[model samples]
Target: APAPTPTSTPTSTPTPPSHAGRVLLPHPDFRLFLAIDPRHGEVSRAMRNRGVEIFLLPPSLHDPDLISSSSPSSLSSSASSVGNGTATTATTATTTTTPNTPNTSTPPPPFHEEVRLLASQGLFGSSRRLRAAVVAAHARLAAACVRVHKRPPDLRELAHFAQLASTLACRGWPALAALVVAWRQIYLRSLGLGGADMVVGLRVLAQMVREAGVGSTLGVAG
Candidate 1:
């Protein structure tokens, strides 16, 4: 009798990772996620090589907080989302192949309920107090960055939280968001200052200040 022929095992190709609604990186030791949306695979790879600890995300899924979450999940879970870049971040990064489970944990409740709501309601009796609250909020947020990141929060993250806080207990979200965007533009185009670009930036800054100072409120948009 002829010896039975050996059988060969068939192999399946791996699926490419999807970035949408998934947490690609582990959150070192915090609740909020630092998300990125890398358009190219190389971009994600480069950041990972640098040990940036970022995850790939889709621009459309900008709002991590808005990601429909269920019961509390472990921080160790693969599900992730972004901070501050929720609305209009143009950056990108890598993603994981986790089953599409929504993020389980929500950020802590907004602190100082009075201050967060006072600015938007026109209840602030003095600019001094309003300015003080904003500054204090900024300081309050810096603690997280220093404790975890070992440095003061960068302008981008700082502004992100500032705008985030304004979305609730601080002031007008639009104005704060606009200010964050303006600052971003200024930071990006810092070289353009003392030139025509500076004029444009200044004009925009003035317009933003004027609108914010109007002491009017628009309902918070989702």
Candidate 2:
């Protein structure tokens, strides 16, 4: 018996859409707060060495939306007093003013909204037309975390990190969001958020990092 030959056709792999331009790493501070086993203290030190600050404040002292915008002149004066460490000053000077007047006029960005936007876009898009700037930023952050963190994290964990980033973004802390995206993608993968307990724990950690920044807190960890 003779077998007939079959013809094969070649097809192109579909490319993911490109993410549009958005603020990724807006230069806001990055904070990492979790109970560090003494073994991981080295990482904390490394983060500080790299100019990423660290803080160990108690939970009672938590607040993220307490930003107080300042007049450019007043900010400049305060920065000069702090000397040339402008990165440090930028945060302190920006958040130093007592908000004598609360800005109830404008509502802050919400978490769900950002999530909806993210879900609409494929988790990662093609090189040419990626998703939003934030997602692309997260991918970069995830890659960096793979290099730095003790264990590499997977896409699910990275997605959770994305959610946390969105939470920060809602708080007018887009830069913090970007940093979290990067750090989580880099470090928090295999660690696994675990079950509901881990979810609660991560929320706490996210808040800790958010306030550890200079704009919201009085100073940077340095």
- Residues 1-222 of candidate 1: C-alpha lDDT, one tens digit per residue: 999999999998987668546558867885544443221123456656756574433343343332222111211133233345563322222234233321112222233332333332232323422333333333333333333333443445434433443344333345445444534443324323344333433443443233223233333222
Model 2 lDDT tens row, 1-222 = 789888888998987568656557744576545544321234556655766444544332232321122111122232321235653432321222234322211112233323333342222212111122233333333333343442433455546654454444444564544555544553443465345323433443443342333132111111
TM values, all candidates: 0.20, 0.22
Q: Give the range where candidate 2 is weakest over 10 consecutive residues by summed lDDT.
A: 122-131
lDDT of each: 0.36, 0.36
Off by over 4 Å in 1: 1-126, 153-174, 180-214, 217-222
